[model samples]
Target: MRRELKPLQLADCAPLGTEVTDTDPRMIYHGEMIPVMTPDVAQGIKDARRTLRTNRFRPTGKRMSMIIDGCAGKTTLLLQIGRAYQGLLETERRPDSVWTPVVHINVPPRRESNMDWSLPFADFFGMDHTINIEKRNYRSTDMTEPVVHHMKESGTSLILIDGVDRIHDSELTTAFDYFDCLQDRLRLSIIYCGRGATDIVSEGLHHRRRGERLRTSQQFRSSLPVMEIKPIPFREGAVEEWRSVLKAYDENLVLYHHEPGSLLDFETLLHERTGGYMDTLDQLICQTAQQAIEDGTETITEEGLNDMVVGRQDAEDDWA
Candidate 1:
């Protein structure tokens, strides 16, 4: 139930110097490593970009979301999409004008009113959302006017909100109302990223603001498209994707002795080691690479991978 990105050739890195110098090229290359464009990240960005592009001028723009369970790289995927979209907007933006086309914020842990929801956006632009009515007393200001003003002024068209899953059922009413108000006024495209996004959005359909009718789940789905990122399954046909992900990382690595596509040799082993979870796989690869660099091995070995344990620690009883 996912779209595949067009295959891309991995960028080639210069070979590290054999001369023993004071600076280690291994460490240097490690710091310069870029985020791997895994299948989820690539496809998510593609779909999100298309949605954002199509919704650019709509009076009521469409919504999109990326949901990933656990630490399967939802934040990474969201940030990449935001950066890619922002890069697209930058080319058309006036060189002298200071405008933010993308706004990224995290859903707050605590939510009481619409003001609470607005706080994160205000904090992002460093706007003050509090008013001092008296010498010692202050009250939260309704930042709708200022927030909308700055958004419109800055030409902000897309908002990337992380952690939508944290919103309590009680807070959904105000939270959605605030979002609805923004859509009605600004027609901005929004991307929600979180573990519980699907359930949250489905549940949100049941909670409607006073005097407002709520849309069916089907209608919401038509408007707000959803994408999910889960652990890659190492089964028939699906195993190839797992290897492709590893291949992407391996090609980007700068290890001197690591043969291109050598990682594919351990495809099944790597999946078994990390259970095909992106975060664990990433940690395993990165930590293993760093260890190899420190140990002067300069290459990843199956034995080295066998020794690493990352991600949610299992219970002592389950330990191998």
Candidate 2:
């Protein structure tokens, strides 16, 4: 298949603004968890997979994946889904344990060392590193063999890999493809976490690095499960839960945070501020509260938020 196709992105479903006239330190605070909101797309993925299996067809277990770009609560949602999946599998009659529980892995961080994933995997599991890090033998391929084997036996059927774009393209692709093959061997389900549209999953099924150690030069790769998790839509349900929490700290959060009453202006403003990402919204509100505390203000108002941002920006510029 030589046809070229574009992957669906959040931008496609919902238009969002990109330009930022200025940045604020408190903006980072908007990236916390808002547990009340539902992960609708993720739930749909799980539901669809379950339905297929219940129908008695040969169901290739679907991997639940979310792309956590800088703004989206990808990792948070992944954890949420994992928790829900755990509850479902814990039932006495269910065979979820036979499938892999959630296995969380990362690609590697940027501006760091050579990003050997085996290190984190080993350290996370309290397993010995293939060799002493100080030793020269650590970089060789032989060391990763044991780490790979342990992962296979680790009973991780549902793999959730974050930091996907952090590693070298070729190396990351190799490691991802290897796990995908394990799915064929052991019926493992694959879930990926990454940035932008790197096309990792499609390429994964095409390359059979383990069986033939071979490459599928075929043009179009198969699609693994993918959902570009955008932020939550601005509404009463979304804001009400978080706003209630924020009200205990700074009352200013409730300024626009009324009973969502189907108001487009409020909805648009909230969504604009939050971009629908629950974590980002939480951070913003939390920062507002922290600023209120620092300013020695008891009740926060709309004026307070503006004053806080202006004061912080000025302070940051002075320090710079």
Candidate 3:
């Protein structure tokens, strides 16, 4: 909030440029200059939204899963998809109405009951989960009816459940059973996200309805197509892929002394440092940019990058 309140004094700070006076210096740190839109991310959003479009009004809405390893920006991709879907929803809905077409909630960790699963939706809608008894005494409210009522009233069509892997093995059956029933009740497409969301969802499908089988193995995996966001490989055929991403970052940088292709020049070094993981790569560049700004260099350099250690890969390399 402090960052938003105090805008960068670009008018007085000549080196920072007048074009970016409205933007804060923290933009470099947050990398908000350019959206997190990689090729795979773009395609994933396209495919997931396509599934939502086709299945949203069906009896039992179809689902999708995203399987991206840690540090590869799975959450970023999910949020981007939500933003895109919300944008689409806005055009189709009443201008004055308050309708949430895309709802995102992190699947609760260590979930133990159906009520526990409903909390995410309640939290999303800002509905209180506790009912007041006498004199400030409170008890948990059954959120099912309110949650469903609000979802229907708001015209929610898509749900994004992030961190499916966090649902404990013991809790999968209970957690997904509620999700399955919710999807059926709302007739909305759900995109489950995590590192191994496919396996987790598959396990849930098998155990859906407390071991009472409703679908076969082929039907289970087929209904929810998985999208992958693996790290960009720095190999002979894919070096340009890494360079292109860096080039996008370079073009969007707000540094005073930044050369057009300065980041692209360090392509190989960055690939080695971040192991092509988007989250790690984002951290490395943002931190390096912050250091450059503090030192008044206003440009990224090999020396600045060398002083910082980011990601588990870099730490392991340091230990070795």
Candidate 4:
């Protein structure tokens, strides 16, 4: 039997964040993420896990890259994949055992040196650099060694590097080299999330080695598969899909119909306005809901949408 949807209270409209809590149905249901997993994203996750499992037998693995524009929910998707993998580990574990199946790190912006790239990895593993280095006189690489060991011990196979576009051009080689080191030593599959395919492709081309530099240059291009996350198109039944998402939050909510002289459907109009971007669509829905609340109505009217659009323009103008 299908369960009836519940209406959302004001508190249920909180701004969405990257992290998702399994226990909060409101957060999970009404979040920016619409629970519509794209085939490419799903296959990417599967490939990462497969590579990890394959490494257990033969130790040869490959890496994946996701090139998505800003505000396209790349971080949200990565977090979801990481959390889902962690959940899987929890199900197959003893109560006292620890499992760390995924390690997600946001590459620091404008990193100019090798150590800068390595520090995040060391920090993620909670390695005490002061004690390991000052007292034990350990090298910088020594701090990162434990990460590899822990990953191997904890059954961790996927390392997600976010903000790959943030690495400066001058330090691109250094960053890629560091990733190569990790791949070779830990036998882990990696997923690098960047802003655009052009940046990644150009960098990969620029670093290609013809002679001595050729070895390191081809490292990224030779094995890594790059995938781009495109916007969800508004096609047949798209309105129904979006309506279902809205209903999850507010069962009483209704989409306002066009009054007259409207050439497009609401879903098509939304897609055209927002370029079918998930984050923009989310913001529009939230803002429309807020407007509905202010007007003491459960429906989002055309007037409310126009106000929201104008308000967005005003905000942009202010920034400008």
Candidate 5:
């Protein structure tokens, strides 16, 4: 009864109350959400924003390109940047003088291939790709052309497109055309994210010779100043420091009563399992909390953390 508060109570008790339940995994997991910040992740955002300000943050300028490799926390950082930009645009509202951020798009790919070269922006902006069977006089061009007109009228700064790896090679070539066009057309910042396309980039556009493709695109790699997000720095006795993180959530959630070995097992388990991705670490902590609840225990146990690693049924997508 005490844990289940009224709907209004949740709002009224803001900053004052927290719901505690024996079975709710959120009790510990929500409170103890950890952020793994490295120089790469932290500095990239600073540098990206600096680049945006310097590049005039408009699509008319040279399209800013950032190629982040796998597991470098690219997606997470991009979303953070989007939110930060949203806040800035919301504040700097000079309807005619300034442009504002509007939408964020994450497109993987469609089932059928070979979309029109221009459909990258239009298809995402709600143009019907399916052909008209009943002589419906439906034209995709008409649908897309208005969006360009709308952008010219409205104050839209950018349309962020994330996860470009899913686009097929043919589709990607078509996308390049759209990017080239959008740069000339509107104030749209098209940000694309993918892991395995650096080679394609090296081969297609800029390489001087056939074998020199990889070496030539070293310019792209070397050009960006090597921003890599790394794991949280841990000292020799870092397990003790990790325990303090748990204690911050709830004193009862700690292991070994504030001793050195308090969180050694968890630290080792997570470091081995996920290499310290913040999302994986948060999931691990939540899974442990659920185990503790089911076991009717107060302290997070070594077995509980291990169970989280082992019980990842969706091994490919989950922490694995």
Candidate 6:
């Protein structure tokens, strides 16, 4: 027998916040993923997964980069991949043994030194004790080797380095040199996530010292293949598709869709406002959902979206 429909509660919907929850398996397995996948992003995932699988035994000593604009969902995709890979590793784990297939670390913001870059790895792999010992006995530049050794021991085949763009312009050469050393020593497949290629390549060109120029130039055109993320376009059926996804999540979820001024109208407005960026779209959905719950209407309307815009503007004004 078919059950009676009820308004979907906000608590039932996926949680939304500033933190990147894309890697959370609960959300992903429950079909809360962003419904759009560009060809570039799709191909990049395929290539990266293939490299990881291939190098798991053969040791490719190759690396790849996924370049996307800020808030273009690079971290989301990387986290998703990491979660999936870690799940696979869990199945193969021996009794009382740990296997970590993917190690993800974010490059520290506003710092561009090898020490800063290597510290996250030590922390991620829980090698802080070893790192501290090395710090007391050896120079800061020597800390990375122990981390690399720990990674190898842990059966980590794929390393995802997020926020590579955070590396300062002055430290670009050092950053690339460190990456090169990791590739040479570890023989593992790596994926570097950054905002855009221009910033990454330009940093090398603009700031490299005279002696480092030739070497840095050679590394600038990375041997690793590059994947560039393109913005998801606002299309004719975008709203309908998004609505269908929402329905999949909760059939009783009410949304505004009048004939002349339909949901597509609001979608079109949003697309124009956000330039089809996924992050902004996510924010809109979250804001609308929260507003719907608070109003006890269980319905999303153009007015609600307008309110979100005004609210955001007011917040910014307050800050200003």
Each model's lDDT: 0.70, 0.45, 0.72, 0.55, 0.50, 0.57
Cα lDDT of model 1 by residue, 1-320, tens digit: 01223322223433444443324545555543557777777788888878777777555434443343344689888888888887777678653444878888999876787777888888888887677766655777767778898999988777888888788767787787787678667767777778767656555645743234445454543235676687778898677678778888888776767788887888887877777788788788877776676666778898888777776544552665
If both were scored by lDDT, which would come out higher, candidate 2 or candidate 5?
5
The model with the greatest TM-score is 3
Summarize candidate 2's per-residue lDDT along 163-282 as a digit string, tens digits.
Answer: 665545456455654555455554555556665423544444444322233345664423433555654544665665434333332322222222332222234444455555555555
TM-score of each: 0.79, 0.56, 0.84, 0.64, 0.64, 0.66
Cα displacement (Å) at residue 217, model 3: 9.7
The sequence of per-residue lDDT tens digits that candidate 5 reaches over residues 187-231 is 455445555444433332343332353444335533332334445
Winner of 3 and 5 under lDDT: 3
Local accuracy of candidate 3 as per-residue lDDT tens digits, 54-128: 665555524443343233588888887777777776677653445777788987664777787888889888888
**Best candidate (score: lDDT):** 3
Error of 6 at 317 (Å): 14
Instruction: Put the candidates in lDDT order, highest first.
Output: 3, 1, 6, 4, 5, 2
Candidate 4: give the clashing pairs. Answer: 209-213, 209-214
Clashing pairs in 2: 29-283, 30-280, 30-283, 30-284, 31-279, 31-283, 100-157, 231-276, 231-277, 232-276
Please give the clash total of every predicted structure, in order. 0, 10, 0, 2, 0, 0
Which residue segments of model 5 deviate by more than 4 Å?
A: 1-39, 57-60, 94-102, 111-143, 200-227, 230-265, 310-320
lDDT of 6 by residue, 232-287 (tens): 56577555544433333333233322133244546565655556565666666566
Name the runs in model 4 displaced over 4 angstroms.
Answer: 1-71, 94-97, 128-142, 197-206, 209-222, 235-265, 309-320
- Global fold similarity of model 5 (TM-score): 0.64
- Can you tell me which runs of candidate 6 are displaced by over 4 Å? 1-40, 57-71, 88-97, 110-113, 129-142, 198-222, 235-265, 310-320
